[model samples]
Target: MSGIVIVGAGECGVRAAFALREHGYKGSVALLSEEMHLPYERPPLSKQCLPAHKPIRPKADYQQAGIELCLRTRIEALDLAGHRLLGRDGSSRIYDKLLLATGARARLFPGMEGAATLRTFDDACRIFERLRAGARLAIIGGGFIGLELAAAARAMDVQVTVIEAASRLMARGVPAEIAAIVEARHRAEGVDLRLGMQVAALVAGGVEIADGSTVAADIVVAGTGATPNTELAEKAGLAVGNGIMVDSRFRTSAPDVFAAGDCCSMPYRGDWLRLESWRVAQEQGAHAAAAMLGAVGEWTTVPWFWSDQYDLGLQVAGWAAAEAKTTIRHLSDDAAVAFQHDDEGRLICAAGVGRGNRVAKDIRLAEMLILREARPPADQLADPTFNLKSLLKAA
Candidate 1:
């Protein structure tokens, strides 16, 4: 039947399917997944110890919602002109409206095809199985994925050696001040951190560094980053840049076709931003579903993300540009929050690192302030005794 078809079954695709029903759309909805198993949560794969694969929604839930869930279905061709999806098995599906939520694939290092990369539940399972106590684990790339896995490996008594090409961890978005706290915590947990080192290639025992040195390891994993899965969209002749280009309303260049999540890049404040966060995927999916059903609005939610390593929790809201003016608020010993404001003193971004969600409340309030464009005084933001909620009230 020709109806709404979501071309992926990740968080964005699954959320879009349910959101269509929730928004009172009395139409057929089909969620297609190339995976053999049901849609599962991916965030916990690196955080929890041998975490049980938790499905985003039980099977019965989809049946009750009248959403057809297709597993092991790979769409090989997209006939955008004809509005049809061609499957590998000579099967075809017609859709009146389509959502491309293919997500992204792990970026692999050249000549290291055997090295593990965590993108699927099966990948996580294999990595965890190999991470036994006393095993020497070598992780290349000190980004969020590599660092989080390092923390998990250390907790299991495994020796982890993190090799980062950059001078510090999480250099992409996190400020150096916050990255220092994360680095200190990792070191305290007995993690061997090798900074400012470029990986030459994979050697017999472990990885070879550019300095003609090698780190011995039982297993090697690459956590460089991810490349968006834009092959299907590109083959279909969609405008593809860093990702599938979409507007603020999640509308692609083609009519009746939408994309969201890591697979798509939408416009922000005078720029195009493609975020790879769980919250963004969830929010974008719901917002795109509403937009598909004639909702007239733009997806202007403030970008935010969080990470957990050992006992420390880090949360960041908005873009914390390195060149932006920063104000610090001391929460406690070894814990503090940083706020970035523009030249006009408008709150642009906030980042906080503390023990176990201690910075969550303030960071959330800061997100609201950013959304409201509240320009509280720098002195007020720097004072820990000053409640951030008061700024919201005053605004």
Candidate 2:
């Protein structure tokens, strides 16, 4: 075998290389990255990597893992029919098996230039340079990425106001009540949130809303969300709905070619859907690696994600249909839970804020609910009597 060729050197891409070696695959691993810098951790690209990171050992170890890396190269065209790839610099590459982890790119505001987004290492560096001590930043969107930027800006003592087109903060993912709590925390930290406000335009020094009020700032950061990189797959004529379609084993339309990370769409709950969560990126990458190595496992995984904003930590596990019945629970008067139902009245999703460990337990419940392995009643699931895992094992 000629080894595995991995694309996009981010979290999923790096993990796939490590996973291939960890699973006892004896073959060369090649990674293609367009970034000039070596493959780096992204979570901190928002948190600490800009200024620097606390524990820098992981960054060093990741490179020493025996994976060959090609930096600053672009794979312009993927010839699936011929089972070969063409690069931007006119080089040909072939693989025994391949993984497309091309990842996601930031959605830009069409008319805006000189704007900033926190998607890649370069974006983070640029954003950091503009973050002078007293600079005012206007961030668009109120999702996890946007809120994380708010926390980072607030940490640097910069003035920031987040503009969300949605009615509430993180309304699409978090439960309404939890969203409200997150909103309060951010506001208390002096972050001005313009909810239910659509951005009409991004200017040189401010944001003009659809309502015609202009919010001034020294810099503008847009976190409107991500659009998965699907052009290469689409051009190759793969079954593309929201993303490159894949099966439970992370196998793509072409049997020998697979896709994972943010560019992949797989079965969830039942039908095919695309997810951009961190867990999805990780599990799919590992599963795709296994599938490529001829040792595949069931890839149906409990989707989990967490967001840190101000002093609150929100964790969600499992998929919650937008129309599912939702219940709100309060751990303290300040901390709350938003639980969702999916017609069977089973818990489809749970979002919580203000307590990380508390939310961790409920997340476990949400996972069991998805697997239909939780034997306790719904009341017990919501009970604040004890730790979630303890309760599950106790009862």
Candidate 3:
């Protein structure tokens, strides 16, 4: 009998597989993965002080759920019209409904094919093996992955240098005010920061800067961001843009096929957004599973993500534009939350940073406020004593 099939076997795919059962579909569920290992958590790869691999769920869980877990399976082509997936091993899997949660791959630096990138558990193991104390490591990019790696390496007593083409760290989404605090923490931890510097090439022993100076390193890692794994979707003649395009329900251009997580882009607040957050992947997986089960509703989960560097914890909810009006709430000397409001005074985004989950409660509340379209007063947001929970009730 044909059943539901999910591709990729990352957080999204695994979550959707379980969600399908939770939502009472009760049909056969099969999860296919290109990797040989069990579906593992990808976030801890960059932050763990020691080499560790954590599976999303144990092997017994899938067996108990009667979900067919197939690893080292690669789908070469998609026969969308036939509702079939052509495998690389001369096999085929027919599905009543298919989910493409293929996730994303790391963007490598030009001519740096040999440089290490932390995307998979195997990749993390290789990097960790080389991260001995006093070893010099140079990371290309100042984004979350790079910074998190720097922090982890520092904890291991490894020397770290972060190289960024942009003028500031996390230039893509994080605000400058919060970025400055992160920069300060990294500096205090003895990380050598090279901002606004272009990489000329990957030299024999280090990275060559645009100015002809080579940053010496025993190990080089590229945290240059990720690109969606949408080749299969594109080949199947589905709508493709920055990622596989889907509607509110995650339905692809073709029938009986859907997508979610980093592999797909959906409409958000007037434009299409492709988010790479772990929380987004999990939430979208459940949402898409319900969609596959004939549920109809808009995917309105707010875009949220968090990062850890040393003792600092940073979280951001919703989309913060550069021109949005901002208000700051000082939680402590080293902790603060920034709220961004649109012209109509509606809460659009919120960001917070503090020591060890200090700002987690506030950021979570701000996320709820954004979802409710709350136009909380600026003074209330700025005042530390004003309980954010009250704002949620008012909304």
Cα lDDT tens digits, model 3, 1-395, are: 58999998999999999999898888999999999999999999999977577999999999999899999999999998899999999999999999999999999867567788989999999999999899999999999999999999999989999999999999887778888889999999999999999888888989999998999999999999999999999898999999999999999999989999999999998999999999999999999999999875889989999999898999999997888898999888788998999999999999999999999999999999999999999999999998999988889
What lDDT would each prediction earn against the true structure? 0.91, 0.78, 0.93
Residue 231 in candidate 3, Cα distance off native in Å: 0.5
Q: Name the runs in model 2 displaced over 4 angstroms.
A: 53-65, 111-113, 373-376, 390-395
> Over the stretch 111-150, how does candidate 2's per-residue lDDT look in tens digits?
4455688887678888888886789999999998989898
Of the two candidates 2 and 3, the one with more favorable TM-score, higher being better, is 3
Residue 364 shift from truth in candidate 3, angstroms: 1.2
lDDT of 2 at 278: 69
Candidate 1 local accuracy as lDDT?
A: 0.91
| Model 1 TM-score, 2 decimals | 0.98
lDDT measured at residue 99 in model 1 versus the true structure, 0 to 100: 96
Model 1 scores worst on lDDT over the 10 consecutive residues at 107-116
- Model 2, TM vs. native: 0.92
**Against the hidden reference, what TM-scores do the models get?**
0.98, 0.92, 0.98
For model 1, what is the error of residue 253's alpha carbon versus the real structure, in angstroms, after optimal superposition? 0.6
Q: CA shift at 153, candidate 3, in angstroms?
A: 0.3
Considering summed lDDT, which 10 consecutive residues are worst modelled in model 3? 107-116
* Clashes within 3 Å, all models in order: 0, 0, 0
